[model samples]
Target: MSTQEERSGRYLDFYRDNIERISENSSPYINSFRQNAIEEFKKLGIPTRKNESYRYTNLDTFFGHPYSSYFMPSEPDFVKAEEFRCDVTDLDAHGVVLINGFYPTITGKLRELPGGIWIGSLSEASRKFSGMIEQHYGRYVNGNSDGLVHLNTALASDGVFLWIPEGVSLGKPIQIVNLVNSDQDIFNQHRNLIIAEKNSDITLIICDHTLSPQKFLTNAVTEIHVGENAHFNIIRVQNEHNNAAKITHTFIHQERNSVATSNNITLHGGLVRNSTHHYLGGVGAECNSFGLYLSDKFQHVDNYVNVDHAFPSCKSNQLFKGVLDDMATGAFNGRIYVHPDAQGTMAYQKNSSILLTDDAKMDTKPQLEIYADDVKCSHGATVGQLDENALFYLRSRGIDKRQARLMLMFGFAHEVLQNINVEALRERMDNLVMQRLKGELSRCASCMVKCV
Candidate 1:
């Protein structure tokens, strides 16, 4: 057999041998889903270059290396986390920390918010909210869709779960910090769920970071449900080490008159792929999606977004931007699908990228499929280098060449950052973008390795 076949066989063997251990902590209902997911994975296998959705990305090379299958839960090292914390930590928010995909029990009382908001472990909540969890746990995610998603569903044992009852608005945001610390190569899977009832509101900040230089893989899935007339805001930041890879999927379902927004910011990683899906299930729902990625060296970043307008009078807007240097690679695919019965739909998408070096690469696809007659939809994409005239103008104004170049690059990336309405979060992103432009983020002593 070939190297690819050999790698596949090894993964199959490991899954078959660890079936029992992987489901040791799972409930019977979830275990059944896991079994079905494993079977699905066996049929689909891993994605190859031949796959249309994965044609630009090559996964076979990464599978050649062996990685640990499991990570045991342990007490988190807060002292170690201080070095990686960002500016958002100072905001007024409830903090939830996870170490290597396991929730850490820290000292303090859980913040009691107005209305009824419960934040805790999904595994612990399974006992009391089993029925509620069962009604929506596997409702949004399809089990047989992708091999990576199936693998995550098969092995995920614990993650965060949040619930907001009707008519309640959270006084502050909820910050989730996932810190990875490992001495050797490892794999981690996390499953998260967020549910908001009618007329409720919430804000969430998810931060993913690596504490060590070890090679690792993270597969995570998050399912969110927004009830009628609710509002939800979420910001995701991925700043892992250069030796790590991450594949994450986010699924959102919006009810009638609901509003939702998601901002995905990728600063550093060796290979990162993010997939976000939004379903507008009711009339007059709206969604706003934004993304920004800065890469250098041999780093690779891919982003895929799919928005489905199933009902009439729905709106969606997507904007994504990227800056690549050296030999970095980046891809953006945005798709908008309007159902035949969905009349009066409005959708817009735009993707723009800047290649700082000749060796840099970028691929973008903005697609719109509209079946309705009275809908307005448009899409566009652009990939090019900085304007030499603009760069020269800054240089002539008594600015150094390096600083001028940085200013031009930041000007290209600031449009996406401006979509963030939160003052604290937007400021944090601005500072990080400036540091990245100046080549200082990875060079700091407390931070991890450089993307290059």
Candidate 2:
């Protein structure tokens, strides 16, 4: 067998060997779902390059190294969860911390959630609201088609759970921090569920980081449900050490007149793959996707987005931009699908990149499929180096070549960064991206690794 197949076989064997223990640690009501997912994973195996959706990404290569499951909470390695807090602690947002895919031991100190909202560990939420969790846990995802998602469902132990009752508006954003730290090669799985009832509104910030230099993989899956007339916004930042790999899938389902927005910023990682899907289940639903990736070294970043306008009068807009230097590589695939019943659908997708070095590379694909004749849809992609004229103009005006190039590249990426509604967050990201371009950023200094 080939090396990829061998790695797949090893993962399958590991799952089979640890099935009982994994199930024992999970809630009984979800045990059957977990079993079914594992069986599905066994059938699908790990996705290979041959798979059209995974053409630009190869999970098998990332999984070639042996990685044990996350250590139990009682382990000594998990006792330092408090030291791994995100740098945004001073912000007004409420903080929810997770270490090794589970709630941190210092969770008690978190501010009490406001009325009409429930935020805590997923396991506790499952026990308290089993019916709701059961109805929506795996509703939007297809395990048979994606082995990575199936594996996450089967092995995931805990993550953040949030619920907003009808008509409630959270004035402050909620921050969810995920930290991966271990002494050996380790893999962590996180599953999160967020629900917003009718007329409710919420803003969320998600940050993922690595605390150790050891080889590690973090696979996270999140499902969000937005009720009628609700508004939901999410900002996700992935910054990890070079020895860390990250895979994340986010699914957002919207009801009538609801609006959803997702902003993904990829700052650093050895290998990172992010997939976000939005389903407009009701008329007049809207979704906006914005992303920016800054890469260098041997880093690889892939971003995939699919927006489904299953109902009429729905709309979606996607914009992704990247700046790559050295031998780094990146890919952006954004697809918009409008159904036949979507008579007034409006969809647009755009992907652009700037290569800072001759060795840097990027692949961009933006597509639109509309079954409705009256729909207005458009898609476009562009990849090029910094404009020579703009750089020369800045240099002649007094700026050095380095600063001139940095100015042009930052201008190219600022289009997407401008979409951030949170002022403080936008400022923070601006500094990080600038530092990254100047090669003055370190994983620890960038808030990916905890130094204290």
Candidate 3:
């Protein structure tokens, strides 16, 4: 039998060589950070199925395109983003636009931010505060050892930087709209950072608005730091073209007595992957995570979440719901780890999926490892089809067959969606989900006899 090193493919070797070549080119903008990061990236390289965290996700096949094959469209070519507006009335929110991988200076109107809030480009922030720029740039991200993270950090010449000062609370959500305008086969990597100081409160929304005709790759990373007694909420809505690829990595670090919540909505995409890692670094920290994904056709969506209890008395709760139809595939993995010193920790996790087609694939796993004897922890997962009795009950009410099925499907998914807590955003998601479920219900109703 050949040794492990003998199986190291040429693809890995090419990646390493390219890293060295690019770093040595001496581009002032990227050369300094690139050399050190590239070396670490080579040491880490790409993760294989052997990695427990990615066992269910096949990154090799998912990221088959050459690293240099990503196309860069100059400006807004096919992305007609004017179609998406902040339509909610009486809502005052700041908006920033990113077209393809570059941010548009003249594309979106700019206004003064509320006092005590800093929102702008990372480069701009780097210039204004070099100390902060240096301390947090690569602190939360381990991109050097991860391919997608490495690629994002290496190419993050432009992205967002948001800071909320202490004791300030923004009543309205900050909307950051991402629009992709490029030819087919282009790849985009976006990195964003958010820092909330002690006792500050804020809300943020990330809307993916792109209609690209090509296979677009959006490898994005968002790092959030919640200071002591801070409160924050983040909602991400992804509605991209059918040929687009999406990967999101979000990390939240909480201080003592801090509170953080994140809700992820996968309305539509070709291949979407979402990862959330929360560190309960201080005592009394609380974290909440909820996710919903609706998959159809050849669409593929993967979600992985991990919560770490590094201190005593931390509380965490997680819930995820998935709906898969046609030949689509979806997966969910939620894990919680309690350290030995986290004796008084409290954690709960649950994941459920409703499969509307036998051809559909769904994977659900909930894991827990408690090193503390006094901790309270539990995790569970479920994957099954729609309830026949519920469908019959709805149909018996004289509702249309398609409508009846849609109600049954929505009932299973609404648990997570309703928890959104924001009426406006919740209504928008409700409408999109209505359309998706109705479409699936129509297809399922047509094959109702055969499906049984």
Candidate topping TM-score: 2
Candidate 1 vs candidate 2: the TM-score winner is 2
Clash count list over all predictions: 0, 0, 1
Using lDDT as the measure, which candidate wins?
2
RMSD of each: 2.5, 2.2, 5.6
lDDT of each: 0.80, 0.83, 0.72
Tens-digit lDDT track of model 3 for 1-452 = 22223223333454455555433422344335655654554555555657676666665443565333332334344244434455444445666766664455544322346867888765556566566666566667643245557656655555677888888898888888787654456667667878888999998888775644556777888888889999988888877655677888888989999999989988777778888989898999999999998888888888888898999999999998889989988888888999999978999998888888899998877888889988888788888987888888888889977888788777777888887656787876776688777773222111112211
Residue pairs in clash, model 3:
184-214
Which portions of model 1 miss their true places by more than 4 Å?
A: 1-5, 76-89, 106-114, 443-452
The order of the candidates by TM-score, greatest first, is 2, 1, 3
Please, what is the TM-score per model?
Answer: 0.93, 0.95, 0.86
- Model 3 TM-score on a 0 to 1 scale: 0.86
lDDT of 1 at 25: 67
